[model samples]
Target: MAESTLGGGAQAASTSLKNPRTAAAVRLGLAWLIVGALVALAFSLHETPNRGAAASFSLLIGVALGVTFQRGRFCFFCIFRDFIENRDSSGLFAVLSALAVGGIGYAIVFGAFMPNPSGRGLPANAHIGPVSWVLVAGGLAFGVGMALSGACISGHLYRLGEGYTRAPLALFGSLVGFGVGFLTWHTLYVEAISVAPLAWLPKTLGYGGSLALHLALLSLIAALLLRHLPELPAQAGGKLTWRRIYQAVFVTRWNPLVTGALVGLIGTFAYLRVSPLGVTSQLSSLTRTALNNAGWLGDRLVGLDGFAGCAARVVDTITNNGILIGGLVAGSLAMALFTNRFQLSRLTVRGALTALLGGALMGWGAMVSLGCTVGTLLSGISAFALSGWLFGAAVFAGVWLGIKLRLHA
Candidate 1:
């Protein structure tokens, strides 16, 4: 009997060693150790006097972003598309929760930034663009691009880390589109978008009042969204314990509401410290620099540096934005591996074509709108920018149109 029991134990040990999940967990652990070591090295040995802190902080935030996005599956395109196609309101509710939490965070941050709170001047670096035809056009294009490409800019970055082959082509298309947008920027800025108003709710209503109104609106929206969603049954479980917590966080998908709240908090912290939550400025910089080196882009298009939003600026080394992006990719990749969700899929010819074209449209749209979903919609609305609202509505409309036309199909 003892010999038989020993044999069974040995077999079980061997089986555990060969488990794919165990292998994935090992890989994930190694990746995180490497990440931690690198971050520590940067913090300890960075050459810059004052910039090290910001860069390190940005990378940390990026990692948080990547992890949250991967676990929550928080792709804006997927969220809306799921609801439209299958009546899944989970993502929408998550979005509302994020926006509500983000609004509150922004309000507090804004109050701190401008101690007076009732001052006439807007907070620095807010993404409040002029409301005009250009904004609508940009939003529509962005939505269509997202639908066709299967992801947004942020989505592409994190997905790329997961070995999605199509993401590279989409990102490359974005670069080309940005170049095109720059070529026509002068005409657009002068003729249509330059003179539009930069509207902020806080300026007109004050911080407290704006907060109250936004909270109320968000509550109503959440309530309506709940009406559309069927209730999920409560799971039968015993007392909450450490193993359960670990399982919830690492072994299973996170609740969207929880994920959204964390994302909002990260965004708020990021903006307060480094800049607004933009991922494409680095790509824009690369494109612009390449154009300048080749002398294709004129000097007139170099005016974005003076702007307050996520405008591209030339840099010889990695900027904070680059660091944040890198962190996001690496962090998400680690998490995906840990969860055994890291996958690499080949693209079909049609899919490849769609990715390229969709990427181009997204790039152009981002340039026109001065931000993508993260920059314009998420960060902008958090800051109470009217342009954010306009752009978001337009994006929804475009997505609906694309779905109706079977763009993704």
Candidate 2:
């Protein structure tokens, strides 16, 4: 009787596996096969990417990063929360580890690829040109707003794609922040931006030394990760194993470091193709154009003339305008459908308004500081830019304070 029951159970399991509705695994397997073919096709193309193609490559990298980040549930805010609230270091380790790798990679690339590493590096935009006190203040404001909004600038974008009903409001607030940024740009140019201290890695220590330092830092972060891993209370039926650890490390998709590096590569390509690693300028330029068309302010800002002109070449795809924006939305939406996690949920009215306010602050911060968390902090840090570090420090402080104030609590 026992043997017969065991056989029946095996038969049921087999039947379930053969069900037509069980399409996910089949689809995933087919995707891998197609990916293999596409990779082969790319290799067959047999042409080294020029600067222009490299820039396009960067866009593709950004797309990959977006997909990875979405699937991994990786975010700076979550990283900090993991440490502060949950006593978990995995998320933070992921960020710092990625930073270390990306930082070293940037140093090597810049040191080797650039005509003059001491000056601006290969892509003129990659330079950590200078630092200003205003950056510290701006960073602080942005951090505070991010906490209150319950999302950062990039956070809102990704979350928006995840069906966060409040994300749009947050983004709208960010636009207003950009407007505020425009209002303050003139003062910033004179009082803050021009005199900000220029940061150069080679000047402080030679390229090789800096790269070594970055690698060492990465090792230290990994060590910290080992020591500080959180002990999550197991779910009622959960069993821990190598597979579970693997799932935790990689989640359902790509790693954050790879995504970030790909983003950096895309930045590298962007430098070769059109402009720098920036999103605000293009958006700001668009804002300027719209306002001008409405008989609003023009000839007032540095970026306005270009948007007003809408010159096809520069105004088109140069900045973070097109690819990052579109790819993030697309990646998130696609992942949602794939994972069966799509849902539209609204926050409290207060929370919704807070998101908007926070978003506005982020936009303003990005505008005044010349970029947002991704552009200014992540990309900037990887490039060894002083502004990036300062911005990071400031943002962290602000988040701490915001939490203390219970803004998002």
Candidate 3:
């Protein structure tokens, strides 16, 4: 939580970017070109190994996203931090802007064209899936835990991408927590999610009505956030200010809205290529595999599919598994290289343990609730699910309580 850590990284990354050194720029340009070429080639190779192409594409995307995320230091936890501790709204603006862009895009794609990935019937949109008591409880727990852990699931990924040694500890704990969640999956589904009512904007209000409502709500939140930001002083590092706030929302330099939209578009295109956006499930799947290999889980989880429940398996496969999670790590690494600051972080035992505990809570809470903040909150909102809004509200409340308790401090 030291501003210096966030501050130093940015100055370092920026200074490197602005460096007049020809050799460094050449290196960066080459890397970007290589990544781009690979993407093109991968898409063109209709006859090549399809699965490998998907994985490779995913890995490449991850690399790029990681670098951007690490260098940009964009994160949900920080957004909330600015709001709770600093009363700044820049971070929130980034989120809203991204959602705004994404919403407009999705409205065009799903609302009108109704083209499926293959130009088939429109893919089943999940603005909000079934909502239940479990969602509220689980989301609240995950949000509070994120504050304590200093990051949410996605936040942890970006930190790890930046070479934060503590992040892997949190990730490992998340794996264990996922395992525990799987063990309890039966009770959770039978008593909670299975019985939950599926919420959708299409049913209550037409798609047009739903989209308008969402846009207005998010816009209102953004306006309220704007009002709170002026109270904060601009810090050289991570502090929020009106200028930075404007930059976050309006500046094309690195708008969160644009970033999130690109991610959404990529996710949508990824659905074209392989799947929709998803992150935690793949990790959970990977964890399930590891646990099964270790004889910890039996056949119950082996080859089990959440696809039936999620209904966007292809998007989930590509977005969650390949892009978001991998993109984070890749984004950070790419950024570090540009900055010439690629080094593993060192951390105290206490810090490591704290991350681990926090990760466990996040992983478990996410599973019990059926998604993380990004998956459940952001994506769900774009889909215009009432549950998504509720989950987001719960997250804010939890963050507030955590800040009040000074858990982050």
State model 2's lDDT.
Answer: 0.61
What C-alpha RMSD separates each model from the true structure?
Answer: 4.7, 7.8, 7.3
In candidate 1, which residue pairs clash? none
lDDT of 2 by residue, 217-279 (tens): 667867867677755445545688887665544344555455555555555554444444554
Number of the top candidate by TM-score?
Answer: 1
The weakest ten consecutive residues by lDDT in model 3 span 307-316
TM-score for candidate 2, please give it: 0.74
lDDT of each: 0.81, 0.61, 0.63
> Model 3: residues >4 Å from true position, as ranges?
1-48, 52-57, 60-64, 112-122, 125-127, 231-264, 271-273, 301-324, 340-343
Better structure of 1 and 3 per TM-score: 1
TM-score-based ranking: 1, 3, 2
Model 3, backbone clash pairs (residues 3+ apart or across chains), number: 25
